[model samples]
Target: MSNTVKIQRPKIPQDIKPLDFCPNEENLFELCIIRDCSIINEDIHRIRFEQVIFKNVIFKDVSFKNIELTDVIFDHCDLSNTDFRNGSIHRVEFIDSKILGLNLSDASLGNVFFQSCNANLISFGYSKLKQVLFDSCSLRNADYYESTFTKVAFKECDINEASFERTPLKGIDLRSCTFDRINVSINDLAGCEVTSNQAIGFARLLGLIIK
Candidate 1:
């Protein structure tokens, strides 16, 4: 029951040099490897990636405003509907990435690690996630409004209709995650650690007629 976040793996220096996402010359990219490029619908602003490694990059319908990623590693990337608004990601590693509707609104992520990512409707509004780890991620309809989570972890995530409104799922651990219907409330489900049929489907979503 511990998601003790520790993702700092991307201090790459195996002589990587294929960096080419040129929106008019250098945007401070260091130790690079950006392969199989396809930057469609571009508006790349304030781009800065360090210790970069992005294989099979696509980034369709790109916006990428105020971007600055450190120790990046995005293998098998697509980044569909990529906006990444006001971004400043650190220690990033998004393996097997698609990142559909990927727009981290007002973003500021640290020690991020997302494996097997699809990330459906990924939009962390007012985002600020620290030490995040999401394995086997699908994250259906993800949009954590007013998002601010520290040491976040969701393994085997699907998160059906996900929307943690005014997000505050303290020390969240959704019991090896797999959501049916989610749009969190009830004081953000204090110290949320669900299972046992997601606490009777959250007690019938607070109607409480479960005999």
Candidate 2:
């Protein structure tokens, strides 16, 4: 286990700035209030984001590697092909965002809230998540293999073809969600809780003869 944590350095604080362009190489963005910005192809590495609000921003192909996001709020942002690998997220909220092909593998999330986000093909493989809420999100082809989801709730999310294979889910709940193409064996769905409609959809896709 690599415990080499990266600490965010304190810089001069200011109000939210509108950035049109971003860095092409690896850089550290600390305590910068970047709102309504669009950063493309930036390698954001080992930085700390505090009290920052990235509202209506578009981060295309950005890599958040080994970073820490604390007290940050990403509202109505578009994060496509962004890699959040090996990062620590705390007290962050993602509201009404579109996250496609985002890699959250081997990361740690605590006190996070994802509300009404379009998260497609998100890889949460081998990650540790706690006190997270996914409300009304479309998580198609999301991978949760070998991840620990503690007190995580998918409320009104459409998780079609989401893979939860080999994940230890003991006390997780799925509320008002659709799971049509979930890649799981019949034994994997045992000891899990779901609504009647979800069960029917799972059975129909698996060709199970439900009497």
* Candidate with best lDDT: 1
Weakest lDDT window of 10 consecutive positions for candidate 1 = 1-10
Model 2 alpha-carbon drift over 4 Å, by segment:
1-32, 200-208
Compared with the true structure, all predictions reach lDDT values of 0.86, 0.75
Candidate 1 displacement at residue 162 in angstroms: 4.7
lDDT of each residue in 16-86, candidate 1, tens digit only: 88968776567677887989978788787888889989899888778879899998899989998788888
Q: Tens digit of lDDT per residue, candidate 2, span 5-91?
A: 122222234665654344434343444556776787777677667666777889887887987887777888998778889988887
Worst 10 residues of 2 by lDDT: 1-10
**Best candidate according to TM-score:** 2
Instruction: Give the lDDT of residue 65 in candidate 1.
Output: 90
TM-score of each: 0.34, 0.81
lDDT, model 2: 0.75
**Residue 143 CA error for candidate 2 (Å)?**
1.0
* Model 1 quality (TM-score): 0.34
